[model samples]
Target: MNQRAMIAATALTVMSMGLLAVPAAAQEKEKCFGISKAGQNDCASAFGTHSCAGQSKVDMDKTEWKYVAKGTCKDMKGLSADEAKKMKM
Candidate 1:
C-alpha cells in the first residue's frame, strides 16, 4: 500500500476503536461523590437550592468541608483540596 493509503487506514482503525471504546472507558473512569444531609443544608444556605441540589450527595462535616477545584478555591466538578486552597477567590 502507498504511504497515503497506509496512513489513512491507520487513522480509520484508530477512529473506529475510539468510537467503540470512548463511552465504556468514560463510564469506567466516572466517579461518584457522596454528600451528607447537613452538608446539603449548609450548601443550600450559602449557594441556594440550585447549587446544593444535584444527582449525587455525600455526607460531609460542615466544619471540615472545604470545596476545592482544579485551579480555584470555589467548589467545582473536579478539584483537589490543596488546589482549591491555593486559589485566592
Candidate 2:
C-alpha cells in the first residue's frame, strides 16, 4: 500500500478497535432508579412520562433513573429495575 493508504488503514483499524471496546464497557453499567437529578437522567423515564435522556423535571424522581456502575445502585440508595417496577405498581 502507498504511505497515505497505509496511514489511513492504521487509523481506521484503531477506530474499529475503539468501537469494539464499547459494548464491554457498557456491560459494566446498571440502571439505578430514583437517583438522577433533574435533566440528568440517561434515557427513557420509567413511568413512560418521557422517552429521552436529560429530560427529567424533578430531582430524584422515583420514576427517573440513570446508569450507575454495576452493583453500586444499592450503595447509592437507588433501586434496581425490578424494585422500581414494583414501586410503580
Candidate 3:
C-alpha cells in the first residue's frame, strides 16, 4: 500500500477498534447506596456528609454510593439505585 493509503487504513482500523471496545468496557454500572466502604465511594453522599468521593468516614453509611453493575445491585446485600433514589437521604 502507498503511504497515504496505509495511514488511512491504519486510522480506520484504530477507530473501528475503539468503537468496538466502548460497549464492552461500558458494562452498565449503577450507583448502589450504602454499599461503599469508607473512603471508597464513587461520588458525593446523598445525605450531605461529604461533597465528593473518598470522604466517607464509615462503611455502608446508607448515604454513600458505589458503582455496582446494573441488574446486580438488587441481588447484592445493599440498596439498589432505584431504592437509593427514593430514599429520603
Model 3: which residue pairs collide? none
Q: State the lDDT of candidate 1 residue by residue for 27-80, as single tens digits.
A: 422111222344342233222323543312444422223333223322333333
Task: Please give each candidate's TM-score.
Answer: 0.29, 0.69, 0.64
Superposition-based RMSD of candidate 2 using all C-alpha atoms, in angstroms: 3.8
Full candidate order by TM-score, most accurate first? 2, 3, 1
**Model 2, residue 52: what's the lDDT?**
97
lDDT by residue (1-78, candidate 2, tens digit) is 899999999999999999999987878888999999999999999879999999999998889998888989999999
Model 3 poorest 10 in a row by lDDT = 80-89
Runs of candidate 2 with Cα error greater than 4 angstroms are 1-27
Candidate maximizing TM-score: 2
Residue 36, candidate 2: Cα error in Å is 0.3
Error of 1 at 77 (Å): 29
